[model samples]
Target chain A: MNLSWMAWTQPTAIFFIVIFCLLITMSIWEKISPGGGPRVGILRFETTRGDRLFLSLLGSAFIHLAWLLFAGSNLWWAMGVSILYAGFVFSFV
Target chain B: MNNKPFDNKAWFFVLPVFILVAISAVIPLMTVVNYSVQDSFGNNQFFWAGTEWFTEVLNSDRFRDSLVRNLTFSAIILCIEIPLGIAVALAMPRKGIWVSVCLVLMALPLLIPWNVVGTIWLIFGRADIGLLGFTLAKMGIVFNYGQSWLQAWIIIILMDVWHWTSLVVLLCYSGLVAIPEAYYQAARIDGASRWKVFRYIQLPKMQRVLLIAILLRFMDSFMIYTEPFVLTGGGPGNTTTFLSIDLVKTAIGQFDLGPAAAMSLIYFLIVLLLSWVFYTVMTNYGMDAPEKREVES
Candidate 1:
């Protein structure tokens, strides 16, 4: 297989490289500190650390999507909305 | 989980999420409802349309076609992603260092913005500039996403699978990990095959998270706009024009606010109704019996 035609743009390369680094770091972190025991928060559901991270990420996506749909493409406003969303998820969800 | 003592003060902590969702969801929703029944033709001048737009939109072949396309896309995505995600989750390491490594890698695609995902695919599928496209051409296969309807559909669907299957994997993995060791040990001691163990033990345990996964994917795919918009622009002769793309074309592209608003309300209702049906059907089955028993005890 010829690999000569590969398009290794800076952003694409950076994206994958960062992801690779994240995986390595996360593995090392998990190896060092093993447990992610579930804890009940204000949401009335038991969630682990990973669950909270997922919730925050999902919530922020919705925030940005909603902002784009309704408020138009003023990203500063969307960022503001996302920050509030993150705060709420981190605190309760 | 519902057995916690009544604590009215807990509402304070919940207030922020409620407010945030309301501001994002409810207020814009009301605006859409308002616009749906009113006609505006520049200069902020408005006249009461009184379902005229709704009648028009309902009667339009374009709107109906796009809605059908949207449903088909969502269905296809769910069928592909849910099983694929579950399989990936099952294959994932249950313990040790590799678990985090796999999780972070799987989650990487999801973190990238929707537009960026589309752009990546757009560049990656171009015959002149992309490896995939170039390789296909070299193999003497005609592949051009920009000009061919089928190719555009294929790319869009593939992009969605790449972007979202990870969500399903993550949720299922979480559910899988949460299963107690005792249950697995019991299954092992009973000499159950792997399929039997999954069918009886893992599947039932995953039902709740699976329901959540299904609902989220359905809603997101139903509302999908950015990725397909950036990729195909609802094009190659409107073959990939889902409801949101068509709605935006009506509202912003042509500046037809009344009909667009009507279409938006209809679109929102379809999503809400289907999600409700999915939630009720999934939760009301074998899941509810245990909860009822707990309450009785």
Candidate 2:
């Protein structure tokens, strides 16, 4: 609620930290196996692990925003739904 | 996975680019995300808004209208430029001194600064002193972009086509010239018709470049701001106010930081979604064909 230089609120920082961690994890995964595992899923295209991560993250952001608008501010349910959605994306899409 | 040795030194080369991206894109984007979730009064004071601005922007008729307008513009131009570019590229000499001349001419418009491109069109479309406007007047076609929305749209579309069609042409030309002489010789030996040659050989070769052209044009046109802003100022009753122009009006013209920030996130999300869809669909379509063909053969 209080302003700071560059608007570095705690939650926002956490959001970015999570994204950074995901990137580092992905990099490590790639280092272990240089060829990313790309497969055709429900999306009907070849998507590497990195692509799946991107799709999941992008979809989750929209899901989060939509839930915030329609279901009110308690985002715990939205978070749960997003996790299931991400799992689905990783497994099949 | 191939057994390539680990090379931590690669990260040293990549780190500078990563830092640049973090400083230029990530930091600024985080600031926007922060502003989007907070309400701001003057003097840098802020209160938690908690998605209120997102709701407001989503519900606004102005946002809806501008989005529709933006999508329509992008669609119309893509329809025109892609085919037209292909034809022009096809017509150009595949090998000769004239190829260099053609390339230099095509690149001229792209080299001009964007605002200058806007300024050029703003003057060129003026009914009083401009060549296009004067010619239209002489032909008995009444032309006033300030009063008529259709006329304003015409000029904007025309300006865009003139400025950007070269990009498509250049890309398609590259795609065309890359076709080895053997393919053409084979087509000739087969006695294939012109249309057949293009359909089987030339068109398939051009597919990758066409994808690049379409993606670039879609993103650029969807986020267009400067040319229309300079030319029409989003006037003629806001008929030409696309998403970026409207976002600027919200953020800078009215100085509403929260709503503007929220609008930007929405805009970015839409663009990201569409770009990904286009990328997936195009890559999927092209990457599957050879497998099927090989199996059938």
* Cα lDDT for residue A60, candidate 1: 57
Give every prediction's interface RMSD.
17.6, 2.2
List residue ranges in candidate 2 displaced over 4 A: A1-3, A24-38, A68-74, B1-4, B278-297
lDDT (Cα, 0-100) at B192 in candidate 2: 98
**What docking class should model 2 receive?**
medium
Chain B alone, TM-score, model 1: 0.86
lDDT of 1 by residue, B81-199 (tens): 99999999999999899989999999999899999999999999988998889999999999998799989989999999999999999999987887778888988899999999999
Q: What TM-score would candidate 1 get against the native?
A: 0.67
Model 1: share of real contacts kept = 0.00
| Per-model TM-score on C-alpha atoms | 0.67, 0.88
DockQ of 1: 0.01
Fnat, model 2, is 0.50
